[model samples]
Target: MKEKLYTLIIICFTMLLTASCGADHYMKKGEKYLALGEYYDAAAEFKTAYNKTSPKDKDKRGERAKKLAGCYDRINSTQKAIAAYRNTIRYNKADIETHLSFARVLMKNGSYKEAAKEFQLVLDSLPDNELAKTGLLSAQTAQAEKEAGSRYIVKKMDVFNSRRADYSPMLFGDEYDQLYFTSTRNEAEGDELSGITGTKAGDIFVSQKDDKGKWGKPEAIVSGLNTEFDEGACCFTPDQSQMYLTQCTTDPNYPRYATIVTSNRSDAAWGKASALEITRDTLSSYAHPAVSPDGQWLYFTSDMPGGKGGYDIWRVRLTSNGLGGVENLGEPVNTPGNEMFPTFRPNGDLYFSSDGHKGLGGLDIYIAKVDKRTKKFVLEHPGYPLNSYGDDFGMTFEGPHNRGYFSSNRGDGRGWDHIYSFEKPEVIQTVKGWVYEMDGYELPDALVYMIGSDGTNLKLNVKGDGSFTQVISPNVDYMMLATCKGFLNHKEELRVKPVTESEEYVLQFPLASIRVPVLIDNIFYDFDKYSLRPESTKALDELIKLLNENPNVTIELSAHCDYKGSAEYNKTLSQKRAEAVVNYLIEHGIAKDRLSPVGYGKEKPKTIRKKLTEKYPWLKEGDVLTEEFIKKLDKDKQEICNQLNRRTEFIVLRITYGMFDENGNLKNPPKAKEQDNGGSEDDGFVIEM
Candidate 1:
């Protein structure tokens, strides 16, 4: 609660007051409270000083106005900030930063065009300034962002909200039905208001769902947890046994610095709280603790030294005995601007709030996903509604689901943070596999063994029609193998890509039969020609890969023809076309000994299978496409039968071809031998498109 509004406001107050010691009594007292980061006390005292200052004293009046504006901005008093900054700019336009500061307030007030003009004015002098550039971009974006909506549907959760601030919601338990948050309502244990916020110090509160999933009334914890000091922003361990929260203790003489505290949770109630000593850097502030999903690291925000700027997210290796090395999550996670309130999804995707990156104003939430290649976190702005000109932070997800709760101050004119529930209706990631026999149909008895680099090993059984759907984590590489008796295992590898919307990855497992020939679809040839078509490259490449996967197997590559062609003509054309496929394979890397070319012209007919029958309802299962059967059909049906008969296929000649030699010993495991190409790439004649 007490952060930028406090820590930053105090520094501004200290720099502004160089006036005489004999200045008004109100001014002197206000300066004292301001230096101590007491925002509420400082604002009250400064108002008295401002009213009493004479209009004739432009020099002194402008200084007081600037001081008041800085405080108002921190306290999130939009109208007050605007009025005060306008007054100060009227007298102190000499300060370009003042214009930039005023423009930011205009942005928060939704005066985008006005904000753009102010930013352009700042840029008129400091053309290359980063802040001014960002301000102009944000102003333009806010205008468009107004009409843009993301997939997320957010609803204000007023069930546990109070007139005062209720923020930092935490979801726990098996069903994520238990809700915990922090509030500064009158119901808080403290009788006195905080000097920083002018409200009762925040205390941890809880709300639970009934059998019907409706949340009951929320109650503040009055036991050993709540004290006169402010406490909020809590996260639980992976097991939900221990809670880490942020607490701010008051010292009348020293500036308030936030620290992280831990509390043990028993059957129902939380027990005594203790300070979690992250480091001995007492001069710095440590707050907003978020434990990593694997429970190996503790992530938090700090103004501690070695940070990129205002506040940066940092973490320490969590160990049984004590904390290990600490490191700041450097840019792009950390920027020259503030980044705080780090949280995580069950899949380990990092979520944090920041004003540092390009976003829709104050502390927009961003997701950081590790790149599979570089393995470094990259930022993604989730877009508007989930973000606004007002501050939005503190996100809590309900397990792996895209639905969850976060805290925002978007609609609250007083800038009081409240809880809101958010759900991404269709942002799911899954892998669907169709396990079946190659050139045949679905293998209902097949089972797939899924293996992942993340140590995921699962036995996924295919459905009655040989399909299996499994939820997959983003950025994981999975290897799946379909297994069934009398069939060679068909393996598929997939690396799921990360996206902001729902995505389904489809894979086909056509397990080759141990006895029958497997037809390679999509391999076509020109009319009455032997050369392979360019469109046939993909299917040919897949066949090459299949042969390499089942290395020991040697296959007979054959081509067939319909009864219309003379036997002599069909045999010669089919043999040459079959050799074209063999030469292409050999030229690409397959050995000649592993492939045998044959032309079964009009001799072998086609047999309709379940999949083919489904596609052609007129064709019955087990029906044979013989010459007489096709002669009796309609022209269209007869053509379909001829196309089915004219095909390319491969049959396994031996599974142990290279397994043993004549001496019954492993043939010194032959290295892949490069085959000779009948023609060179430069030797081919170019074909016009």
Candidate 2:
């Protein structure tokens, strides 16, 4: 029995030695593959070593799990990575970055609440970790936004997608009919799979929209653009005559570096591509090139020395002399994380993707608008449908509108990118205007009171430049009044008809001042009578239209006279003249409550302010007209001064337009104006002034 026990012990010792040897061999092999960035083979070997090795050594087991998780993450095996991260934490609970990584993968898997829990765990230990805090906020925000639903209509473009990764869509070609993108499908031109992604290297693919506006099957671009390595992420000049793309050239003994390349289209085929020649730094990577709308700047993503993060968006002047100095986009645009895929709208808004900045999760698209006042970039994330928990980047606009195609890995659990067509619902029709002095500069303190027939009543203040933009619903008629404290209110009428496309209407309010008595040009009364002449119909009709446009306003129609008539007689004549004008307005659909006739019989005469005095150098400011003043002037000048006094003017009395309450609700919601006609009469109204 003693001899049998000894033999059994020797056999058990040999078996343990064999198991230890096998685990060590696999572990070293996995480490070698990991160093080569071959994540697939590295993961397989790591898994074998992990299963064979004893868990008695907690430190080694935890390290192995961590390496396996990293390998899974690089290979796009998110679930396996998450499981491995969890196992690592179970053994080494103090690993803060592992917790953060675990949370990110959880968020990417659409388990936002779970990810938030993990992120909170990291914050519990570090307390002031910005990355962990950002991750927590991102997870919580993503949960809320996803539950709130989406404002955009997003559809996965299956016709342009493949089972493998397909992304970075660009709309180009003569009619914008051809859609070009990067794909890692099995048929890619590359014979070797990428060690970094563990898939076939990226290649350019194009899909053409047929005459019926339907996308056809995608095919490799192949026209000297694709190589055996990686090529994709392209942008074109506004004219689509040139293409700037990213190409990764793999060297056998050296690491692959992403570089920008340029290709020209000739007779519908792309010419030979040439290196973009940014720098000779072998350690740096450059990609994602975009051209400015004016073609004066070339913007691209790079990891050069001066970058604020691992990767940043940079721009260089594209001049006749050659590429100018490189400028980093900096700060809010670039964080301590990667920022890629920079593009532009026709209006010069910069859109890019960043993982360093606070986002929903992973990579999120953000827009940076140059604040005209601060001269700095203001970042904004167009929320919800455009962004998801998964990586969302590589955006391209269809023309200038918000409707376009972007790349996202949202529903794909394997982190495979696919193209999605997104369209914002018909935006509210916008009406913008600027208010200024009639013959002078902008009135910065101007207030724009808007009253829409569709129950829209709001007060908007002008920007520093006296400009105001307000949104209005479709098929609504809006009446806006631009008023200043010392100026007569200006009225504008707009009727927005429902259309399939978004519309922007611009209106200008050139307001006259109350400091001087503005003449009502083209108003002719009968000889020595209050009755309006036939020629005065045009002026009275315009006054009626103004009243209708400013439905909530009340105006005092003041009738004046020249210095010729006696004071008492002129008073009675002017009173009758003002009354007749009010009666005509009431007859032409002007509410009686909106009209107040005042007779300023020669009592109030015209005065020339600094502006008028400059034009009429013979006159000076604070000079009021009387018989003595008019007689002192020349014949031509006397006629001008007298004509200025013999005028009818409507002074804005109240601009509140009883239509709205202080809270913006319509006081007496009138019917949706007769076809958004600014509460006025129909198109065919005969004005008998």
Candidate 3:
């Protein structure tokens, strides 16, 4: 029994020794790879070591889990990182950093509420930890940010993306048709997968839009510029003669750090590239180059010493000889976490991505502009859709247009970045004018003459529908005159209001006829009263203004009543109504001689117009709405037709009213008389002058 016990103890000791040896080997490899910034390789090794180590060895297993979680986080494997972090906290529940990291991954996964619980846990121990507080705030507001969306219309550019990651779009060339971007597709020149990202290295690729405005299949740039190492996030000078790109040269023994390089265009293609030495800080990593529109500043991201914390955006003077004036952007722009992928608009607005800012988790895109008052950079989150709970960065605009392309890794479970297009539709101001004869259909032959304060003079021909549309400048006042043969001219003054969204201003030109009576719209009277209702003031005021505008024109005001009332009663009633309108017009700065009052009573019924027929489809156009015709219809239709007939209208008596002598200004048409009472202008409407 003693001999058997000794043999069993020796076997168990050997098994323990073998397990320790296997786990230690993986642990050492993981540590080495992690030091070299090879996150993917480190994750694989650490995961293996965590599985191989004895479950009873909590210390070793917890450390291995923590390292594995860090590696997964670096590569943006959110689920894996979350699981690894959970395992780490389970083994070593007291590690605040592990809980903090787990919360951050949860935020990236859009589990903001859950992430807040973990951040609160971190704050329980380190009460003043800024990172935990910021993370907690971010988790709380992420969903709210999603509800407040941006004006930008974003769509995934599947044509620009591939199965692997593609990002950092740059629009250049004279036409802005040549699109350059970074892609980690199979076409990349680098053969081996990147130990840093777990995918092949990203390379610069170009896709040209054809004459038809369609993007072609992307092809890798075959210039001497591309190398076996990582190359991406490129930008060009204003002239696009020089291209600056981020390059990462690999050395298995040492860590790989990104550096900026420049390549000059020769005969259309970039020639050999050379390292762009910004600062002598060889230990720092620099990437994501963006050149200003004026080519005076070269903005880039770096992790150099003296940085606020993680990678911060820095700009340098793009001098004739290399670059200088390295500035850290500071305060509101930079934070303890990463701020990268700085871009610029044509209007000098700075756009960048930030993981440290209060945002919707991961890296959210923000617009930064210098406040004219404070002169300090003010950062603004563009809101959700323009941003998401994923790594959204890299934006490029099409010249002065608000539309452009950007990058995001929102929905891809594989954690691969993809290209997306965004556009804020431009607001256009237009003046739409409709010309027609009064009490008639549209006048398709009408001509509109327009003169603007901004030296805009145009003669627009009306379309078949008697409508003309013209793009109007904001803050410009325009005078438009509508004219048709044998019809009196109508004038309108329009002021284009300043607006930030698309709008169309409508102007109606109802020309007075030389041959027919014109109905004044919106005039109303109550019961049997001759006095105009309050609602009739708008239409009456318009008529008064029209007479004042066309001072040389004279009109005979007439009122008609429905067929329900007796002819004599309607005659007296309409006569009083017409006289009341004339009195109101004369009271409000109109020449009394320009008006003549008459009552048609029920002698001529209302003729249905095309507009009326559209409203009441039972009625036919040009049909007179007599008592017989109205009685055939339903009670609703009869009442509507009767309401149409009870209206005040006018006929152009003469277009040369006050044009002759100034004193004979036709002050009162009722008191004017140079003709017989039997004639056209003297049909009992004139009292002797």
Report every candidate's CA lDDT.
Answer: 0.84, 0.81, 0.86
Q: After best superposition, candidate 2 residue 621: deviation in angstroms?
A: 70
Q: Per-residue lDDT for 309-332 in model 2, tens only?
A: 679999987866778778898888
Alpha-carbon runs more than 4 Å astray in model 1: 1-23, 427-450, 453-689
lDDT of 2: 0.81
**Which segments of model 2 are wrong by more than 4 Å?**
427-689
**Between candidates 2 and 3, the lDDT winner:** 3
Q: Best by TM-score, which number?
A: 3
Q: Write the per-residue lDDT of candidate 1 for residues 222-284, one digit (tens) a residue.
A: 668888899999999875778999999998888879999999988667887999899998989
List, residue by residue over 80-185, the lDDT tens digit for candidate 3: 9988888888888438878888888898899999999999999999998877899999998889879878788999998999999999999876567889998889
> Model 3, stretches more than 4 Å misplaced?
1-6, 428-689
Model 1 TM-score relative to the real fold: 0.62
> Which sequence of candidate numbers ranks them by lDDT, best first?
3, 1, 2
Clashing pairs in 1: none
Model 3 TM-score?
0.63
